[model samples]
Target chain A: MNAIEIKGLQKNYGDFKLGPIDLTLPEGCIMGLIGENGAGKSTTIKAMLDMITAGGSIRLLGKDARESSALLKQDLGIVPDEIGLPEGLNIRQVEKIMADSFRNWDSKQFYDYMKRFNLPEKKAFKTFSKGMKMKLGIAIALSHKAKLLILDEPTSGLDPLVRDEIVGILNDFTREESHSILISSHIVSDLEKICDYIAFLHKGKLMLCDEKDRLLERYGLLQTTPEILRDLDASAVLGKRVTDYGAEAIVARDKVPQSFEIQPVSIEELFIIMAKEA
Target chain B: MKGLLKKEWYAFLQKPVTFLFPLALFVVLAIQTKSQVILMYLPLYFGILPVTLMSADEVSHWERYMHGLPYSRSAIVSEKYVTVLILSVFSMLVSGVLLFFFMNTGFAVPQFLFLIAAAFAASVLLPSVMLPLNLRFGAAKARIALGVIFAIFGCLAALSVDDEGGSRFQLLEKLAGLNISIGALTGILFAAAAVIMAASWCIALMLYRKKQF
Candidate 1:
């Protein structure tokens, strides 16, 4: 069964509209959702979790999210962009609270993660640094034995070392074949490192969704003359820019002539090209 | 639900020093007035305790976080009600004990019971009005809304006291002179407060269910 399935999900704010989005994440894989600020990454996650009343439907682990959300959440762990640990409580107190809050909360696992993260148990949450707060959140999220983990911008502002550590931990989390993850972030590099599949959301619409390998294989950075670009099939070109030396275009690697130079494309470059095209 | 309450319990500890303010005030008033009457106002202070806890929840944006947890919207709404009720009842019980020691020599037992019940009723009234407003508009906006409401009511109360003719206070004073027993009056007040609280809980649940965050 797929970990998450969203169909025709739509949410309309006065100034922005999200969706008509349909995406699915099969069990035991990590899917990265990529978007710019205000591109509706968070909205899609919220809609799928039924946090907001959206226009369509969602299914998590084969059950309708809206109808059986509380039960479904037992197997779901989420780390939102902003951490919400009570400012007054120390990590020790927070442990007790989580222990009481989640029936399946594992105290030993929580303490183990805290030790692994090197988080001080006695320090109040208000006194902790931003990075420490994030580590604490990750520790709580990981300890719960969640089947499908959802994270939003989990590594946005952390230092490189911390980001690498978090990425490593997430990679380790998916070693269990039954576990799946749906993570959203603007940092394409982080997503590229850990994600099995990538989905690009541009202005609330999905630009593309495919396996990481397939996407990398399908699109290439092409440098060619404008005249040659016109001769090439219009459908083959996803986006183009006129440079001082020549015209740079993102084109289908398979559709271009053998003579045309093709370079590898990173997810960041792909997202920028697609966002500009939109 | 236990986990949510535990979370609030720590959040409740956030302002431990502030909790002493009311106790200090009560001590000073007790020394100055030498009357048990000061205990009656304890409900008003304790009622605001729940509102203060809600402010902590807002600062942490807990409502948004709770959506990711294994809690229903109704459970979230009811948590506040249950927590506030516990805090208010605890406050009333402490005041009742203090009232016992400071009771006037000639004051009857029925009047003392009425006083305690009235204090409890007053305690119920604040949360009953404030919880729905807080849930509907959020902590900051709800605080402002409550401030405006209190100011209007204060002004009306002052005007009624000054006018004296056909004022609600006068009606109440005249009722006190009637043949109704103190126990009966307390029962009526308690019953009315109970009805209002039950209705408020329902309204708050509905408002909270519709709230976006």
Candidate 2:
């Protein structure tokens, strides 16, 4: 079964709207949801999790998000961008609460992560720094052995040292082929490193989604004369910018005949190029 | 449910205010035996602060985190009622022990029992008002709503006391009718209150479960 699927999802805020988004993430793969600030990435994630009273259809683990959410959430682990840990709940108290709350909570694994993260066992969470608080969130999300993990910018404020540790943890989870991760982030480079697939969202709509390598292979920017730009099919172009001298344009990388000069494009560059329309 | 209650209990203990509960009343009790009026009132007051209004768990926005865990929304709400129930019982016991030492000379058990029950009811009402308010408007707005309600009640209560035989006086007259024999009546009131609480709790749970975080 696919780990996650969303279709025609709609949510309206007074000033902002989300979705009518369609996307999927297969089991045992990392799908990076890439978007700029205020681009509706968080809204889509909240709706998919049924955290919001959303307007369309969403399915996680093949069950509708609203009707069968409780059962579906069992296999899912989520870390929202904001810290949700209750202050003054030490690590020990958190474990007790989780153990009672999750049928599949792994005691040994939870404690093992606490040890690995160097989190204080008895220190109150109110005293925890931003990075430490995030570590606590990650520990809880990972220790349950969830089949589908959803994270919202899990590394926003961490030092590089802690960030690498979390990346290593995500990599290990996917390597086992029994788990998948859907990570939403503006940190395009981090997602590029770990995500096997990519979904780009802009203004609450799905712009593009494809295999990571296929994206690199299919989309390319060719700097050329306006005359050459006209030679390209306007239908094949995602977006374009024309300067006084020439036009820089996005075309299917492989479709741009080998006869033409080309260079590799980074994921961030692709997001900017695709999100910006003529 | 036990897990949730335990968390609530620990949170209460961790808060210095809950600790101040006994401290503040003890000072009042020390001044004069008559001030057992203040001692009898302490538990309900703490209930308002700790159980209903300014809890640490709510401060941290922990309910959002707890949503996907094993507990159901109904379970979470039901546990809150149970927490207040347990706290009321515990606070009643503490009030009894202190009342014992203060009224050791007289053993006025009937009046004392009435006072304890009144304290418990007063404590429970705060949550009845607060739980719905908090669920509807959230903490920031709940504070303002609760403040306004309290201020209005405070002003009216003072006016009623200053103006002899007002509706406030009649409200107390109903309580003053209690005696040792009225324990059965108190028990019935507790039962009715429990039913109303359960109904309110169901509403809060459904509204919260369906809410957009």
DockQ of each: 0.71, 0.52
| Local error of candidate 1 at residue A24 (angstroms) | 0.3
Q: Model 1 over residues B122-173: C-alpha lDDT tens digits?
A: 7788888889998889888987988999999999887876444656567767
TM-score of every model versus the real structure? 0.95, 0.89
Which regions of candidate 1 fall more than 4 Å away from where they truly are? B158-169
Best-matching candidate per TM-score? 1
Residue A126, candidate 2: Cα error in Å is: 3.1
Per-residue lDDT, model 1, residue B117, is 81
Largest DockQ belongs to which candidate?
1
Clashing pairs in 1: A101-B3
Native-to-model Cα distance after best TM-score fit, residue B53 in candidate 1, in Å: 1.9
Candidate 2 per-residue lDDT over residues A39-86, each given as its tens digit: 888888878677788877888877888777666777788888866777
Error of 2 at A231 (Å): 3.8
